[model samples]
Target: MQPLPRHWATVRETVAFPNTQEYALTIHGASDLSLEDAQRDAQERMALLIASGGPGQLHDSGLEYYPLRRLPEELLEELRSPGGELIAAISRNRYGSAVLNTDALLISDVDLVEPSPQDRAKPAGGLLSRLFGGGRQAELTPEQQDPDAFGLPGLHRRGEHHERTLHLIEDFRARHPELGVRSYRTRNGFRLLVTGTGAGPSSKRARELMGQLRSDELYMILCRVHDSYRARLTPKPWRIEVDRFEDLGTRTSADETHHAWVARYRAASEDVAVCRLLDVSGPAPSAVEQQIIDLHDRAVRPESGLRLA
Candidate 1:
């Protein structure tokens, strides 16, 4: 009987982003293996990773597996993107050392065994799901929420269930210092944005945080004003009205100033017909913003001087 196929496996997995987790699994047998044996070896290796919780703390929910017979373009792009967010999955073959990166993992260059004539091995289904893992852990459930209800030094402890969130924010800030995160005041409350220089781990973490907040309804209400000037500005003759919340005076006391600004915006949104507040709170537009607006205006309303060049 021929010996089982040889498989090479990675023992080190690293995640360069805040919202990611990494796992490494070992594969056995590489002494004398065939093509089919090699495939089975890779499958078992991925199964170990899957059992460990996929790529990161978050399981790979959208990963798929394919035979190592051919490399697809999409898989190649995911593996090659310089600053891509996708996880780098690595695997190795036992024969000619054909490095393969299925949709969800990358196998670094390694030898792969060639199949001998009449030597046949069956294809294993569910390689992707097995390697990527399955299901999110229940450790983060509400019942298991952090015991420290009050976040930070002086924040209230009553019903404030965001200990994990606060930790994530602090970790992100510490990790990415160059970027500027502005928490602007509005009728609703605060709007936090992660912006700054290079593309690094912090930015990736910030994006993930933003995604989580956006999904929460509490954060949504604190982000918008009802009677904003943008909503009230009735473009005369055009029948278009803009009622954007006007940001008020700047103060040294961040908390007080934010609260005051929320009130002001709320009042403005409520009295759209009577209040004559101007739009002064728009975010300081960057060069990217200007270019985008210019392009959009030119495409939609060429008559307006909103378009440049």
Candidate 2:
């Protein structure tokens, strides 16, 4: 599994082309980049982009198995084990939600609905497809091909979706009796934390288990790219009736306006929960798993009686 970098830096520069068009570029580094190192890297990438005559900006492509190496999020907190090993990092996401990033634990986010045909039509490129290529569409089983195969009564009914999702979890538990599974009910689907089955998010075993559980494809790809699993720990801004933060990128500093927005967001989200504890099945979580579970429960307030957002 890839470890989270302790240092982060961003370099910005303006490049003037032969056409007299100047473009502003921003590059990020996470491997304890010094000022000189960042500038050199930025210049090298800028030259490549110029030679290729591509877009002036660097596109994340929503791909990369080691995105955290250049992750552009504001780090909020770090969760370390008693042995002083970093277990997780909480950061403010681009959408203003607090996200938990971890490499040690295997976390899966499974969506209830299947992707539309349009979504499947797009070519699977980037780091994810490069590493875990082929069978993009061929991997779908018969059950996965049918939208109503989950015993969902209606396509738009939330209650039916929730029930079907729970049934899926129960069936999975019955099939794999040796693995420990902690399931949570999310707004769109389910979040699962599994133990006694896999060790790290980057392992083949983790991918196989996620595939067996029908986890979200993009999420699975992200896990592979980041070499870690991520879960949202806070309610979405839209769900709480708050506008998204204006600046949504690698932040050098937080301003008064950002602080005020966070205050309002927290106040509005005070009564909402990100997920609710659905069930725990199969086996007991190990000591390490328990620590992660405790941290997740505390942040998400699974027993708060609040509606999931």
Candidate 3:
């Protein structure tokens, strides 16, 4: 996924949280922005996004904006611990940079690496700042308690939470076109980082809903994502569905129908080479069965027999 481009500081340093109970969001632009500015900006936007129904009460947003392939395995291991939320992906300034816990994580300079990970441990609820009193969340040491948390930038680890991560990324792009949009699923739930500005609801209405967002309402905004892109991507009736699939079997006419070779980049969890039909129809009775047989034969792997291609 093309990450939300960093503009905060030209240079960023990602510290391995090292089993810390909490973590920082991102440091992509940290060099340009002061720790205070980064800290304040991330916190305030996160609060608004939460009020608008973004992920609420997260400790750190994790390394939300940068690309992750650049990081190491040990650092990736740490992100597996539940600690951050999608708030880290939100761009606070036109710079398209964000770091929710700059206070907690970026208090001083440290090492850096690529952002992104694949572990999900469910972010705990409530504001660390609120608990610590007046945004002093950074003062709390890792030894305090809580699971040592870590996370992937931009990428969702898995589960319904992925919906939140993707939604935030889309939200930032939709909210601020100047930042440019990143890859994301379509409005109908299909994974497609559609082009153009988002769809429906003036920015005002969209902002209103976002302000009132809560865990329950997270889906509400995510749903809007599809609407935002539905028009931009290729138009198709089926794409509206998130993971819909059909058995691509049964007899059908060859007319109007089309055939094409297909393969899934996904793992073999699904029947590898299974003939999943896209659509079916026939002009005449004989055509239906022949069309199905031909497609089915081509789709499924052939038995131990060879024939002319």
Candidate 4:
């Protein structure tokens, strides 16, 4: 899983070029770093940036070239198991809603809208691009090209996408009787939480299962990159008619403004639910899984009867 650094800090530096022009650069670090340590790290990185002719010269560089092992969100809380293992974490995403992050207990969502052929063929480009060169186009394997060939039912009719997606979920439940699946209805599609199968987000089994269930391709890529699964626990700001919170960058703590914003968001979101509980199938969740489910249910208010956001 991506390391959720307990500490964060930011450093700023001014670099002077040979042409007598100066540029200011800010860097954020999450390595439990002291101000001095962060400053030193920033200085080293800035020196390299200067050697490469500053930030202006690196317009073509892709994000894959950068080392990004830590999640770039503010950690709100951490959940642990009886044995002291970190089971889950709650973090404030950039859009101001809380997100649930877990290294275990697979969580995936299936969008209602199908991707176009071109979109489906696009490479995810993290470890996949590193293993197979970025220029290579992704080709659908036989199973992806023909899901029906693997005993999975295909959606044949128009406007039945929702029902067809549910059918796929039921098919998955029928095939994998050993795993427990909890389904919820989100505003855009369905959210699935699986248990009784101990597969980490980046595991091969997880990849295959998510693919078979038709989880969002970008979501799968993000899970693989971050080594974790994520689910939003709160309504989107716009959905609740609240403005987005300011981008806090790498600040270690929240201020009065952030607190006030959160207060308003919470108040507006009080009558809204993120998702509604649809059904549970397969088997009962284990003790640890139940703990996660409880936490998730509390945050989402699955039975609130309010409109999903």
Query: How does each model score on lDDT?
Result: 0.28, 0.68, 0.25, 0.72
lDDT of 2 by residue, 147-212 (tens): 323333443233334445666778888888998888886766788988787657767888888887
Model 4 TM-score is 0.71
lDDT of candidate 4 over 156-260, digit per residue (tens): 211234555777888888999999999997876789999977888878989999998988887887787677899999999988899876453333345767777
TM-score of each: 0.20, 0.71, 0.17, 0.71
lDDT of 1 by residue, 31-79 (tens): 2345465555556645555554554432444432212112111111112
Give the root-mean-square deviation of each candidate in angstroms.
27.6, 10.4, 24.5, 11.4
**C-alpha lDDT of candidate 2 relative to the true structure:** 0.68
* Tens-digit lDDT string for candidate 3 (1-309): 112323222222233333332323332222123545544544454444333322222324542222211111000010111233211121221111111111011001111112234323323232222334443333533322211112223211222233344445445445544322223222122221111222232244443433432212433333342122111111121222212122233112132211210112122212222211222222221322233233223433233122101
- For model 3, what is the alpha-carbon lDDT of residue 110? 10
Could you tell which candidate, 1 or 4, scores higher by lDDT? 4
Q: In every candidate, how many clashes are there?
A: 27, 4, 23, 0
Mark the regions of model 4 whose C-alpha exceeds 4 Å error after superposition: 1-3, 9-28, 32-63, 66-71, 113-159, 247-252
Q: Is candidate 2 or candidate 4 better by lDDT?
A: 4
Indicate the worst ten consecutive residues by lDDT in candidate 2.
56-65
